[model samples]
Target: MGESEQKVAKEPTEETAEVTGATVATEVSALPAEAPAVLPKTPPKGSKSYELIFLVDAALPKEELDALIAKVQGIIEQREGIVENVRVSDVRRLAYEIKKRTHGVYVVVNFFLLPSQIAELERLLRLDERVLRHMVICTRSS
Candidate 1:
């Protein structure tokens, strides 16, 4: 093709660059200034809140049941963790049998502990035969 017929590529002009920069600046400035109001409160440093739910065999006697619960709380406290709350619900029929048991006791414990110690806590809970099933969930935003 001849030089005059060939298409030429043009670089962005000074005005084009200025307009792009101004558009970005305006978009950033449009964000809310009070962002903290919409954000969740951060927990204390080096610790996070977690909720532990476990199902225990309902056939256990009252004394043993109480002891097991206390033992779990003790484990958390022994590791320098704080127990916020413990809710023990009466034995209820399970949606499906767990370890051949139709009814089970539900225990919910909320506490704060270091993230690194979660594996150890879960290991200890798994060793107890009375606890049929258990789950740990983080309740606070990282």
Candidate 2:
């Protein structure tokens, strides 16, 4: 091998057991390609308020949609937001199909978030492909 051509080595750790920051490759030649893992999350803890409504794939079961709703609710709670209510309005035909589906499930999540925390919540939603449509509007005092 030329002086310019050299092999590089990497150190391993318990998390992924690989080089750089990537998980080490486990030999399973027969297995199909692995799906990407979701990134680590840091949640907030405390009191806050906001309202978020989103549309999910109606084809999914009540449990499945509920599971995802729970996940989002957890994130909100972690970030100091309090979950007030979660309403799941299952599969309704859209005036027209969205993302090629003629129907979708609706979810309304009422919560309280710190004024500064809205951006974080929005970012999480943007990253999740499950949401077909979403809106977060600040509430006025009653």
Candidate topping lDDT: 1
Error of 1 at 119 (Å): 0.4
- Cα RMSD for predicted model 2: 13.4
Q: What would the TM-scores of all predictions be? A: 0.67, 0.62
The list of candidate 1 runs beyond 4 A from truth reads 1-44
Q: Write the per-residue lDDT of candidate 2 for residues 22-104, one digit (tens) a residue.
A: 34545432322454666643223443446788888877765677678878889887866677667766468899877887898
lDDT of 1 at 1: 84
Residue pairs in collision within model 2: 43-78, 44-78, 44-79, 44-80, 48-112, 48-113, 49-112, 49-113, 50-111, 50-112
Weakest lDDT window of 10 consecutive positions for candidate 2: 13-22
Q: Which structure among the candidates has the greatest TM-score?
A: 1
How much is 82 displaced in model 1, in angstroms? Answer: 0.2
Candidate 2: global Cα-lDDT? 0.69
lDDT of each: 0.78, 0.69
